[model samples]
Target: MSVAMKGLRNHITPVSKIIITSRSKNIATFGTTEALQLDFLPKEAFWYFFKTIAFGSSNPEEEPKLAAVCMEIAVLMNGSFIGAHVIGGILRSNLSGQFWYTFLEYYRYFTGWYIHLQGEHQSDMFKKRSGLTYIWSYKNWSAVTATFHLYQISSANLNDLPVIRTSELLTRDIKLEGKFDALEWRSSVPPYYSYMVHHEYGTGNNHDVITAIESISFTIDRYYRQHQGVEENLRKLHRMLLRIQAIVEEAHGRQITNQAMLLQLRMVRAVMYRGYYFLDNFRYRTVQAHAQDEVGDRSLGLSPFSQFKRFCFSTRTRKIASEVLDQKELQKMLGHLENIVSDMQEFVAFVSCYPRMSRQPYCSYLLLENCMFGRQIEQEKIINFLLEPNHPSAKGINVLPIIGPGRVGKSTLVEHVCHDERVRKYFSMIVLCSADSIGGGFLTDTGLIKHRNPTSTGQSLVIIELADDDMDDRTWTRILHNLRGEHITPVSKIILTSRSDKIRAFGTTEALHLDFLPKEAFWYFFKTIAFGSRNPEEEPKLASICMEIATLVKGSFMATHVIGGILRSNLSAQFWCRFLKCFRHYTDMHISVLGEHPSDAYTKTSGLTYIWTSRNMSVVAATYSLHQASSAQLADLSPILSNDVLTGDVEPPEKFDALEWRSSIPPYYNYISHYEILAQPPDMLPKRKRSRSLSEGLV
Candidate 1:
């Protein structure tokens, strides 16, 4: 081989131009890479520490001479590793005609592919870098050994160089670069999760265990990292990470970090960069353009005899025969170069398939994903609410109520329900939100809010919102039109609110008035908020104040939120004061609106905003029965007044539309309603007269 390498001074083939250098020697002994200028390194430093291991350098300053000799002898015990002497069935089959014919005869034409696998080369070592747990044999020990030696030497200064022996390269001062342990890598070893990176960046390849030389590559090093103590092997692993950082930064343009993915991904990206650079920067992924006479360490295949020269001697040229060839010859060489590129791309794609086979991040967060369904009351209510619309029994037993004062939670309840995946999947899509609620997650500008991120243009949408009387009707109509576009699903439903009877003019969807909770549920729910438990006895007075507010809550989600905020504040007197004030405000607002008694007016007009005919008053009389209604009006009114239960033909009250929105009501409370207040005192129409008028109109 040495004689063959030396004889390479003659022939000048064009192949020599492609590879710049091919490191052949175990180059690490050169040590303290600081000896070389930083410019000597390649780009792609953003990866983690340890991806910078190059095979060996070309003799850059030397004149064109015989190239360095890199003899890669991989052992294939069974086609898996180089020779450990166990011929696995796959290799045994390869030993026959097909394998021998394909590789030995044909693959040699492909530079890196056809090498001697039949030969026996055996050398064993405690995988120094892979953790002492491994004992790797020389399957392709020559290249592996050379690589390890080169990096080991480069890492150490001249004073720290390891001596190479016939069988093994050993040093009293042990320093192992993790990148060389191929055995530590294989399929069975647990793969390391490269640290998280911004969502846009990801590692495209798995680490080649033998070649992965950074902190993120192995578990042992990471474990060593968590603690600083030196427990022999554990200590060594930690130091390996530090060295990896140095080489990766100094040699490759990588930024290693604990963030996980940066290291390995950088290396893979570098690999791609190299192919691109080769094909582009110098046409390396292609065939060489220069004549064989061109000298350098990488021109290993050019000389008829320089087959022995490797990357080690690929730097400066020593042209023996400067006489150039003609154009016809150049064309022939170019054709061959094109073929090589075709072969190389195939090889790169083959390596690319492995990583896709290994990703499982999507399905791993099962526990965390289920956290949204936490509270018992919340769960039941949401579920029942979802089922109400479709259930046959739900028609008469329906639950619809706008539980809010000004800015209460009625709309929020609707929003949460719509966003829930279960609810999202339940209906093709349901209209659970109101118009007053404008902001949503994936909406486009100009009110074109789409329900899903990657929605198929025709997917259903559930629009929820909260509206105020001040907002013009035109705005709500436009919002509805936008919601109905093909970009969103059909008009599942529409819910609106107004303080005046005229507002009933815009009732677009089936309206259900929302009233406050019953005193019992309120007692339990309020106690939990005010005293942090369902035990009302813990703070009876506070619970009492809350129950009273619940009656005033009038099914107002916003009011509950305000009261919830008050209780959460932990101030006793202030809470009572706020409570009393809220009731007073409710009373004052009522007086200023209707004539201080809504039920009297309810008997006159079944609807809050419109002038109900004598017929409408008959329906209103059935539901109100001449009593002042609290938030619990519906629940309070449900069992009583058998004949005329305001199952009227009119819409939900204009003043209290929040109570009517469907999606806002929780499921468990299948029934809730908030009849509009008249703001007028009870009228004194003779009972007999009022009864006669209502009955006559009904007839």
Candidate 2:
């Protein structure tokens, strides 16, 4: 640790002084300051504890030691937490999660910190001493707070926690005692708000709790909850600033930066993330309450509300700090905040587009493209597969499962069909919902409770499924549970889409297994996106472009989309000739666009994200160009995927991959979390599991 940090640490630790209680009744079980400290409390024990966890490893034979260390750390943290509870202390820093994570039981696996950054502080010692120690920092305070809140927020359905405002010390069973069951629940929960992004609010107080609850509630109630999740996280951040503003005012009151003021700030920061979870448990069904939603059926005991609260808090924090705050001290904070919001938005939007990716998924995806549907034999085959002749539920008109790999356009096809005017008018209420899978970002707007059943009595309901399939069976089971009505209350039309053939295999009814778009249609879609509105008649060269597209696509929708996006975006007759030449070169290691290299073109242009703003999408859009590739492809295309790609308020790059990207799906790492549906290829699903996560190891 640097001398400054060491000095800071020493000053931050509270030293207990004797404060004899006025009377016995008030003394109670815990003492004043001394009572606040845990057994064998060491002022700087946390730093050592973290260093051991981050830098040390354990052997199986040493399991007891690891367990002991974990328990000790937990004890120390619980003490700190209780200590804060008594005095209502502030957090140690703007970054809040580091402390709370010890008890949350999420990071018992592997987690560490890195700090080799420069802030224009060029001194050699600054790099050496200041950079030697790495920590989780204040960025992930929201996620930590969320994990902690899991115990509280999930108690909503409990016979306990009768009211939102409870001052009495809360006590309940929040432990995950078994070998991996507890961790499994923790694993399934979203860590969208990680330790890297969130900074701290000094005081762990009632206001932040309220803000955290509001954020989580906003996320839970809103469809496409991930976006709201981010928004709430941003709010927590703004609240964090509010805490800082208060602290600065307090310090300014004294007109000094003395030891007293510094200690006060650390104390305030400590408490901010302390009971930060109090509000996380506010809006949703508590773990104690029966989920009554889809997830409730599968993992019955754990709560995801904690992570949800954290995510909501982190998202809100970064947003308002950039959008509204103009404090001079926060000048650079403004820039960083804006970047965080942009990245997070891109991250959120990308995750939502995963569902509804099948050829017949647009209806399920919620895109009403006015498409036409056909294919009888495939549909029948799906029905047969869904309900085998021997299965008990095989007697009636059964629901069939539609299955494919991730990013395959399953949801898109379903969405397209559902949105068809015929289908739209066919069902009294066509509800397209998502079952957001583990580790994925928020995709569709539909939750298990609110969005699934929209049709009234005597009306037909078409239930289009998305991400909810992973951990939810209630929504689907509800379909069966609701079907035995005596009066035929409502005609239920159900379509299920999932990457898991296991889940799809269980669905029985009319099923259509999506394959890649046919060659002719691929050509049409590719040419349409590539050559749009520009007359093939006016530019006779379109014939050659069309032939080139057909050859490259080769009956693959993905290939067509990727090539078409490129061709249409670079639509000048001259650009087409060069584009064709460039395509040939990629096959032959050739470089095409002259006067500017391809890399330079990526740099000089507004970047692909802005291609949507271009009036003439043909020869100038990104979405139209690569219609079938996953957003993961775009994330890989970053640096080139600049800010303009987000809001699309700017002009596109010259020779851009043109196609107005109406789809809100941004690229995300996890395929399942998309709001729409996965349009994965036939063999891709198994391979993803076989392969290592590309982003996890290095990044």
Candidate 3:
């Protein structure tokens, strides 16, 4: 292959480009021109591809139910084209909702599809100044080994650099390993809760394990965090936790701790379990909290026997009555949480504040082709300002400020200008600085302006992103001074981006205020993200929905990305309408995509955002209530409250708050209300009342 490529390169005259695709790294390296490795489709792109394949030639809008089923299956396909093709063919053969549901059940156990976690490659580590090298391979899947040396890191940091290795899956009866072992901590090992309790119950019998799983699944539906860690005092908490788990496991054994403290700890443990499971599996049920009173109600039948069993070996009633513990428990629970949170915050602060040597700042310079939708004109304008000669009378370095609100494409436009062929030729060196990198001794600390070559001179273009308004004038003045000092070229220039108008004073040239995308351009960009390559003419109904969605989203690139992501997996009219109904609620509400909320089901680890209602009140109560009831009981109660509960007509009592929100709702009503919130669109409620309904809580 190398010889052939060399021969072809020698024979071909005026060859401008050469493309090569190979499973072997050595063969790919034979290309005389630049060799690039292909990357797996991103989540959004993967979903779009699956959606198209699953519903080819037919509008998913027609089969909302089937589309919904397909959506669930698509998420599991993980970026496997082969799986999509096979699954798509299966779905295409049948359109029945029953068939789809059966397919879902079958696919739940299907293990044909798999996601390749990070892969490792063996290669010699090259020394610094060798620059970057890429080597591709096709073991397991196509992967590229990136080799480079950053002078900023010591030998210790290199050793600490996380090495990717294939990890074993946690399954039935796996022995506990590390304290942070992903599954062990989550308590999702062999002889799962279901297996343990299932044997004791007859047909249609409800088990404590079932309730626990249901509760976990319910919690996941609302505030399902994929992973959460309980803050341990590292000072002998491990032995205590292990002991607690052991006692909890034995149906007849009990560990006597302060009843209130035990409940508090259990609550913490349950949250931790849910968080971990939230991260591991998309559809996993964890049993966090269980009712002591409800234990083995049917298994040993009769209340007296249950009481006898409890009296013989009970964790509660050792220190205090559980009912007494419940009374005024809200305040005590809050106090415990506050203390825990305070300690966690302090630990976070200490970790963050730990001293470390500064390293050279790095940024990706691979200019994305056609990424800047409406930034062409802005790029050209910035180029004119950047390359434009400084005034003859002007002294020191000149600064050009590009200002805009967050996510208004300021960085993108400047990036385009920075990477422009003209600008590349014009500037000898280009330094990109983010807001976080700025502080006292900014350039020196970041290694942006190397002191080793202090005497060297070249026309440099320094790009500064002013992230915060807190940057004082002294820092800005010092930053400008260093750019054009004796160490830098006399003609060096600076360009800055900021959301603050106060930064304009620092700009030697007039500030360039970035304008929001024009309606045509904005919609064009929105369509590109939301629709990808799907043709509007072929899917006019979806196209129209897309147009409406554009208006509902905030006019920002980030907003477009988020809404487009939500739409990518969903193509049916019902899904679109559902999204539209809640569109205002989502946009208006403070949706934290960061997924750091400890109490939210949609956790940072899970990367899945559960659809939440805008109605005021925490969803915790509703989540817990649904968890307490069995599926049959929940099913039976859904019909009675289906109409009023969801309509916002069933109002909470006057003087409702967090405590009342928890204590007031019966489990049946709570689940029904939650389901209503999840299923019903906000469009059903009156505008004035809907606006008024929003309270300061999770729902």
lDDT, each prediction: 0.31, 0.34, 0.42
User: Taking the tens digit of each residue's C-alpha lDDT, what string does model 3 give over 422-458?
Assistant: 5666766676776556444534454353112223344
lDDT of 2 at 480: 51
Per-model tally of clashing residue pairs:
111, 122, 12
Model 3 spans > 4 angstroms off? 1-370, 434-457, 470-472, 488-491, 585-699
Tens digits of lDDT, candidate 2, 1-699 = 235334544546553443444334444454534443224336456434443332244221222223323443343343242222211211222112333333232221111101012111111211121222111112233211211111222422332322321111111222211111111011114532111111122233222223444644543344334445444654665565454435433332231223333444334333332212212212111221232122222111122445434433343332232222222323344344444444444333333432322233422332212232222223323322322332356433355567765445666555444443334443444444443321122222232221223342333333445453363566555545444343232434455676565565555544455655444344434555456556443443444445553554444433343455555565654445444433332221111112222222221212221112122221121212223335566455332332233223344443333332324321212111111112341342332221112111111
Give the winner by TM-score: 3
lDDT of 1: 0.31
lDDT of candidate 3 at residue 302, scale 0 to 100: 11
Ten-residue stretch with the least lDDT total in model 2: 178-187
Looking at model 3, report the run of 10 residues with the lowest lDDT sum. 113-122
Model 2 alpha-carbon drift over 4 Å, by segment: 1-397, 420-428, 434-491, 535-540, 553-566, 587-660, 664-699
- Superposition error at 42 for model 1 (Å): 96
Higher-ranked by TM-score: 1 or 2: 2
